[model samples]
Target: MMKNECSVVQDVLPLYLENMVSEGTTVFVKEHLENCSDCAAEFERLKSGRQIDEAAPQREHDTDVITAVKKKIAKKIFKIVAVVCLVFAVLFCAVLFYTGISYPVTKESISLSTKTDSEYTYIILETKAGKSLFFESKTEDILNDHNEVCGRRIVLYNVQYHNSFTKNTSSMSWGKPLNDEKPYLEVIVELENDTLQISNAE
Candidate 1:
């Protein structure tokens, strides 16, 4: 009925190529193509290489999109780990430094031995840890005080030879010094290599 049959052909051309036309439109185009060989030939040529039945193949490569996302995630994880480790290390070192600084200086054991007689006398003072001990001394009636005896050395005792106590003296004397606060322990003895003994008098 339409004089310009090509108008129907053109209208159905797009829908026919896309395979989206209804069955009625397809049948109508078939009838029109039976009379018009030009559009039919054109349609066959247009559809020769192209297939509407098949969809496009999936993409081939990701182009580093996934890799970039992974890299960003890995970087964030590494930064978090680094921050945590750094904080722990700093806290641990701070605790250790604080403990070291606040710690007290340990005192060592002190051992002193003294031997006295009517003659020459000697004393050996030792520490358990090879460290120094708090000690001070005085002679005769020099003032013996804690603050005064810190770094000063005093004569232990005086020994007189060829004088009183002409006997072998091997005696230990434990007495409190009237001047010093600490109790005094004195040992009086004479080695028998030459001649020695003890004197228990008054």
Candidate 2:
């Protein structure tokens, strides 16, 4: 009879710890544990194990929540960095499109003329009508056989943007006087693979 009671108490111990056993079963198990040393020791061990079992899931849940939060934060940071890089790339391309020189000056794109005055002879460069273009001019001295500076060499570059935001003008002109002592014999417009030289003949 005592052996049977011990077995029943042990079986109901887990349910009792979880408060699932009825009050009558609870009283029976408690009275058996109070009297039997072996049953009391077994009940204490089961209670300690149940406490640890209950805490393990809470710890696991907390770790899972932390891991999920970290993953979400990482995803948000990646999106922000991606957007910033895209904006920087677009701005960099826009700067290149607006400021970079695109084409070389050509005869069909401009008209060249010379204006003579009492003191100086002016070389005139003008863009053709309805052209949305600008010019960059670089001047170098023409060298003779002895490396002497004989005249000036003017090279013009035509600049135009690829976008429609660029404003069109009827004409734009650049005029500079030829030096009296060493007159420029050539006004060169640099093409893609060749050059067009304007005759300075009066």
User: Evaluated with TM-score, which candidate comes out highest?
Assistant: 2
Runs in model 2 lying further than 4 Å from the true structure: 1-8, 20-25, 101-202
lDDT of 1 by residue, 88-144 (tens): 999988766643442111222223455545543434443333222222235433224
Candidate no. 2 TM-score: 0.45
Tens digits of lDDT, candidate 2, 1-202: 9999998888888888889999889888888988998888988999899899989999999999999999999999999999999999999998777656355445576666777676566666666443445557897888889998977777766644232344553543333355556665567776655566674554
Among residues 3 or more apart in sequence or in different chains, the pairs in candidate 1 whose N, CA or C atoms overlap within 3 Å are 168-196, 168-197, 168-198, 169-197, 169-198, 170-197, 170-198
Best by lDDT: 2
Global local distance difference test of model 2: 0.72
Q: In every candidate, how many clashes are there? A: 7, 0
Q: Model-by-model lDDT, in order?
A: 0.49, 0.72
